[model samples]
Target: MPLHKVVYLANNTKLYLWKITEDLEELYNEVKLKDSSISRLDGMKSESHKKGFLAVRKLLQHIDYNDFDLYYDVHGKPNLKPQACGIKEMHISISHSHGFSAIALSDKNIGIDIEILKEKILKIAPKFMNLSHLDNLTEEEKIKKATVIWGIKESIFKIKNETGISFPNHIFEEDFNFEDKKAFAKLKFNNKLEDFKVQFDSFEDYMFVCAFQN
Candidate 1:
């Protein structure tokens, strides 16, 4: 599998997904990485993680961008070179899980996260989300809903990229139906309150969430 999907979103946002079918060597040969990226790749301990990193570069190349056009802030957030993105205010957020890697590009503030649905999220649901939201749902529904809430919080945190933001204490998801495929969350951090619009979808056993500041 190559490019899995491209989601065009509101506010000039586009989310790209890549299914990682290539092995580490195949991926490594497919993309050109900068010196720093090369060093980082060399330091990775997992083959799957290395494949994910290279797959992201492959996604960039699919969009006519490359590793040279990508950089990271001191905070370790990925950024596109202004000249390469061809937009003054372009923003990007990236994530990977298991066999998938994803990136979201927007002219507005953005964050994205991809999660492999698992029963583990259910056991830890109380630690991050409101248990009331989990009521009235079957066991399967509980797992799906819990995964979405976790993704929502993760995405919001990625967008904010600030310190001391606790998922349980700082983020709250509004009530929503599983069929709605969208939700809202509030982040109360640093003595400031902020809202985010969340959109998500399930692909295979994986779920991805994208957040935009509202």
Candidate 2:
């Protein structure tokens, strides 16, 4: 399908989402991929992954960008080329879940993630988050909240994009209400404490989260 949704997370920052309704061939036929992307897509083991890869390229097109203008760092973080005529380079983060792909663009550094809600997060919560935060929440609420926390950590990691940052040990989220649609977190790594502002939303059994350095 075309662009699914656009969310303004902050001034000069936008999150673009694409709901994957098209088949693999349809998506592949729509987006033009560079040889590197084609090789990466060929190496993918699942059709779902290939569609998600192409869907992101489709999103780039929605914003007047194409796969040729995007590249990844040694750490696997996505980036956009410097704009023509001296326009500021845009920071980008890419994510895809079961049936959705998303890209966040901003003048400042940013990270984003999307995850499908499931009961399994609760079982693994203690490994990555403070379980006490899950108290007093219903089963459904726990799943939603836990998924948000997980996304928060993942987004933070993407922003930092460095070695030795542990989700449970280095990244931490302040307690947040599901209704607030925003939160705060800190990364305590390398004898430094860095703060982040987090924004998130839910749609169709999926939780989307983005983090900005504060």
Candidate 3:
């Protein structure tokens, strides 16, 4: 399918998920791209990567914006250019896994991430989060929750867009149950403190998280 799902995350925030069912040619022919986007697409070495890039543009068009309106900063963060007349700025974040690509947009600054459930995250749990947070859960639940926590930290990093923000030392997620599907986190870096409201859900064996700056 094309646009697999649309999630209304908050009053001004929304998420879009695209399941990669179309082939390279099909997706490429579906959307209009700027010259820069076309060059970027041509330089991609893999069809999967090309599909993800094109699929993101599809999602942008779904919301009445196109690739021309999107740009990346020196920090490699994706941003949107204002339309003819606008006073508000829209924050956007993008993520892609093996079989899916997603984008989230909101009037408020936000970040998002999606990850395929895998055991490798279990191996690196200590590198990015508190191991104690995974206590009292089956091995399966542990993997799921750990993946969620990883996504939370990644989303938080995307929102902050600052250099030298170590995931293990700078971002901290509060304890919460997998059943709750939502949590909060704190980012302490450069002698400044900030908070975020995190929400996540599982789909097709992948977990996606959205973080709203607080």
Off by over 4 Å in 1: none
Alpha-carbon deviation at 122 in model 2, angstroms: 0.8
Model 3 Cα lDDT, one tens digit per residue, 83-102 = 71167788889998888999
lDDT by residue for model 2 (1-214), tens: 7788999888889999999999999999999999999999999999998888999999999888999999898989888888621467679999999799999999889999999999999999989999988899999999999999999999999999999999999999999889999999999999999999999999988999999999
lDDT of 2: 0.93
List CA RMSD, all candidates: 1.0, 1.1, 1.5
Q: Each model's TM-score, in the order given? A: 0.97, 0.97, 0.95
Better of 1 and 3 by lDDT: 1
TM-score of model number 1: 0.97
Ranked candidates, highest lDDT first: 2, 1, 3
Best lDDT goes to which candidate?
Answer: 2
- Report the candidate with higher TM-score, 1 versus 3: 1
TM-score of 2: 0.97
Worst 10 residues of 2 by lDDT: 81-90
**Candidates by TM-score, descending order:** 2, 1, 3
